[model samples]
Target: MDRGAWLFWVLIASLCGASAFFAAGAEGQRRDVRAASVTLESGAVVSLAEVVDGDTLLVATEAGEKVPVRLLGVKAFDTKLEKDVTKTYGQAAVDKLRVELEGKPIRVLLHSTPKDKHGRTIATLFVEEHDVGLDLVKSGLALVYTVYPFPTMQIYLTAQELARADRRGLWSNPAAVLRADALSAEWRRQAP
Candidate 1:
């Protein structure tokens, strides 16, 4: 082949390769954009199939997938395992959650890490257009657990502090001493 012809073919091949690369990159970006949109705008609405505890529940999606959902930024009274031995003000916290969300459809927004170590979906829950995490903090059922940046982290934290000062829910109970111990026990019980 002539030198000029060989060079022209090489240029064409390079252009084709570049086009393919960009097309693939664009496709990947499209998928990412879609996923982000879903996570941010459209939360999965599911039925509360099982209650893991006062602050967590197992939700059954419309697609028949059962996912364990941990209420973001809140820890309520422990009520799943033992009925007789209850934490101070624990039953009140559980009662509040039950009144707000039991048997209702809940919206679940995903975080960067979808699941925790126990395979539960770590997400911010919502009911009736209200963020469940924020509600828990406002009601003093849970604390603001900020592991990563979220849209309403600051607001939730502030609300939780106010609730703590007001001594709401478990905060009011003198028996509920030692935040670290309570948290550690909760984690240990939940851990697989």
Candidate 2:
């Protein structure tokens, strides 16, 4: 072959190689996106972006969306509440949730009416096979939020009663001295 023809063929080979390289890179990106979120039979498994509080989480989806999810049957003391005792319990609840969920992938089962008035997704979160909301209730860090009924409402209520009986968490220290009924009413009044 002539020198010019050989040079032309070399240029053609380089262009083909570059095209293949670019295509492979694109496919790798697609695979990464898919790996970010996985769909389970009952729900979607997502990465925890932030634990907003005890009952709410910010989760990342496959499309790189950060969605706020409120646990369907759980309510924790508002961390923003003015009362110091309530705020202490709220902070404890947040700390507990962070320990359980931060830097972990969790399963999210969204409710039928997924969005709340604040546009947050209402979901039941799971770490492996354990229900995160129910666990909180059992530990006395949260109450069974019954405003909107859910399938596990009864279980959550039972857990709350047991926690109260066992004098765990808020049910024990701050709440024991601070009048549980009065604090509960105050928390409910200030709930967002």
Best by TM-score: 2
- RMSD in Å for all candidates: 15.0, 12.2
Report the error of model 1 at residue 169, Å. 1.6
Among the numbered candidates, top lDDT falls to 2
- Estimate, for each residue in 1-192, the C-alpha lDDT of model 1 and write its tens digit: 999999999999999999999999999677534423332224778776666576777667776555667776666656544643335345666666677887888887887767666556678878888987688668766655554456777798788678778887656755553662476466556544
Off-target runs (Cα >4 Å) in candidate 2 are 1-42, 174-192
Candidate 2 all-Cα RMSD: 12.2
The clash count for each model shown is: 0, 0
In candidate 1, list every pair of residues with a backbone clash: none
* Model 1 regions lying over 4 Å from their true place: 1-42, 80-86, 147-149, 177-192
lDDT of 2 by residue, 62-96 (tens): 56677777888887887897766767777888998
Error of 1 at 188 (Å): 18
Quality of model 2 by C-alpha lDDT: 0.77
